[model samples]
Structures are given as C-alpha cells and as structure tokens.
Target: MDMKLEVVILPVSDVDRAKDFYAGRLGWRLDADFPIEDGYRIVQVTPPGSACSVIFGEGLTGQQAGTLHGLQLTVTDIVKAQEELASCGVEVSGPFRDETGAFHHAGDARRVPGAHPERASYGTFAAFEDPDGNAWFLQEVTERAPGR
Candidate 1:
C-alpha cells in the first residue's frame, strides 16, 4: 500500500493568532476556516508548492502550544528562501552549516555561521517559528537523490 503524508495538526493557544501567522506572515495558502460546535474551530494552511498542509484547531490536540519542533521545509535555494521568509516578518535565521556536516538538531550547538561552502543538498538550513513557537526549518535541496 502507498501511504502519503497529508497534514500536521499543530497545537496552538490562540486560533486566530496562529492562523494569522501561518496564513498571513508565512504566506501559506489558507485552505479552510471552519467553526464547529462548542466554540471549536479548524483552520488549515498549505505552504507553497507543497502537497502536505498543516492544521490547528480548538480542542483538536493534547499537545502543548509551542511544543512542536523540527518540522522541515525543502527549497531549491536557501538564501532566496530565507530572504523571502524574513521579508514576510517571519524572523528566519541566517543559513547555517551544522558542525557535524549533517542535519541540524533542535538547538544552537549544532549551528555555525553561513551556508555550506558548496551548498550541498540537505547541508544548509535556516529556521523560523510560528506564533506559538512551533519551530520550522528550511533546508536547501537543490538536487534530489536518484529516483526522488
């Protein structure tokens, strides 16, 4: 069977604020905003050119707000992606190369200044967060592995 990942449900403290940050600041396409019973609401947003989307809603999750970590987005150009996210008021960090020359972890210990010297795919990244501090990483993957 083929299984495709579709959505991630982020836990947020305030629905409207989180919605604004994802849909407005990050410029994700607003897919839906539906109000259900008992004052609950569901909001869905999709990143540009992505098949997957993220969602958040009242009463939808037990996860704490700001606890989601290390979600990643891939792009062809790290610098351009960082510039665009920063321009959108997203507070994106400068692209960095991990000290281990591999994927980065959740803290600053793994980060060093500037993009990878050769701009190797999956080697350079920048980071940002949503309003409730759900961290997201932008990774540069200029060339995919064979058959990807």
Candidate 2:
C-alpha cells in the first residue's frame, strides 16, 4: 500500500488574511475556495512544485491559530528563495546553517550566519511565518538521498 500525503489544514484566525498571505505573499496557487453551511468555508492552496497542499478556513480546524510550527519547504537555491520571498514583502529570516551540520532547532539558539559551505542537502535554512504566526522553514536541498 502506498500512501501519499496530501492536504494539511492550517488553523487561522482570519480566513481572508491567511488566503492573502499564502496565495499572494508566498505565491502558492489557490486550488479552491468554497463555502460550507453555517458560514464555514474551505480554502486550499498548493505551493509551487509541491504535491501536497494546505487548507485553512472557517470551522475547518479545531486547533488554535498561530500554533503550528516548523513546517518546511525545500528549495534548491537558498539565496534566490530568500530574495524572492523578501521581495514579495514577506519577512524571511537570513539563511543559516546548523552549527553541527545536522538538523536545526525550532528556536533561535542554533543559528549560524550563512548557508552551509558545502551546500549539502538539508543543511541550510531560513524561516518565515504566516499572518497568524504559524512558522515555516525553507530548507536548501541540493541533492536527494537515494530513492527520494
């Protein structure tokens, strides 16, 4: 059995604002926007070149807005990715590599000043957030592990 991950539901306080941030600021494609009964709604957006999508809307998730953290997006060029997002008015963090050349922490203490010198896969990252403060990270991956 092969199971492929699909949609992730983001809990957001304001539906319209989240929509604007993802679809406008982050440049994700708006896959769907429709209404459910009793003022509920469903909005789905897909990041470019990603098979998975994220959804947020009224009454869609029971989790608190701004609580989700450490969601990741992979990029090939860390510098270009940071520049593009910053140009779109998003507050992206500067690219940083882990001190140990391994996984980084969700907090600020482990950050080094620049991308990995070797440019190894999964070694460098920058972070940002949605309007409701759900954090997301951009990781630079120049090579995939076997079978990836």
Candidate 3:
C-alpha cells in the first residue's frame, strides 16, 4: 500500500476573499475556480513549485472557515520568504535563530525538539496567519535527502 498527499482542504467563510488572499497576496497559482451545486464554489491554489495544493470552498459539511492550524510550507530561504510575505502585508512571526544554527518560530525558541543542537529537522521556519485566521508556517530547508 502506498499513499501520497495531494491536497489540503482549507475551510473559509468567503471563497472570493480567500482566493484573493492566497492568489493575489501570496502569489500562489490559482488552479481552479468554479461552482458546484448547492451554491458552493471550489477554489484551488498551489504554491510555486509545490506538490500539494490547498482546496477551499463552500458547502462542506460541519466545516467552518478560519479554523485551520499548524499547516507548514517549506521553502529554501526563510529571510527571502518572510520578506516577500511582509511586502504583501502578511505579518511574519520571526527570523530568529536557535542554538543549533537554525532559525525557527521565535515563539518556540526555548522549546526545540531533542536538544539536537540543530534547528528543527525541517530547517528554519516562521509562522503567520491568513486573514481568515488560518495559521500557517514557512520552513526553509535544504534539498531533501536522497530517496526522500
């Protein structure tokens, strides 16, 4: 059995606003935007060079917008990424470095995993939230290990 992640459903109260935030502000590529029955709209956006995309729309059962938390998007440069997002008015949490020579969420500076003397295995990262209050993280990592 094999499984691969493809999409993440981000619940939102307003589809168009979310679209503007992700696509217009964040510079994600808008892949799809159409309507489904029951007056719901399906909108999908993918980060540049990313394998997984985020899906958000209406008519989802028991789903409320702005409830997502702890989603991470890894990149190659934390400072550059933070600058880009800040340029677009996104509030970035930090570019703080830990004792392990890695930068991570300043909020978690004191509580790194395993005392590995290195940043999180994923690399340097930061945190931010969308207009809908959906929390997200940006990680800066080197190239993946072979066979990963």
Candidate maximizing lDDT: 2
Q: In model 3, which regions exceed 4 Å deviation?
A: 97-121
Name every residue pair that clashes in candidate 1: none
lDDT of 1 by residue, 1-148 (tens): 9799999999899999998888988889999999987768899999999999999999889999999998989999988998898788878886898989998867667789999998888899988888888889889999998988
User: What lDDT does candidate 3 reach at residue 113?
Assistant: 36
Assess the local accuracy of residue 60 in candidate 2 as a C-alpha lDDT between 0 and 100: 81
Which is the winner by lDDT between candidate 1 and candidate 3? 1
> Per-residue lDDT of 1-148 in model 3, one digit per residue for the tens?
8787899999887888999999999999999998877677789999989889998888753567778877888877777888899999999876544455554433465534332235445655578998888889877676776788
Against the hidden true structure, what lDDT does model 1 obtain?
0.90
TM-score of 3: 0.80
- The per-model lDDT (C-alpha) reads 0.90, 0.90, 0.77
TM-score of each: 0.95, 0.96, 0.80
Per-residue lDDT of 96 in model 3: 47
Off by over 4 Å in 2: none
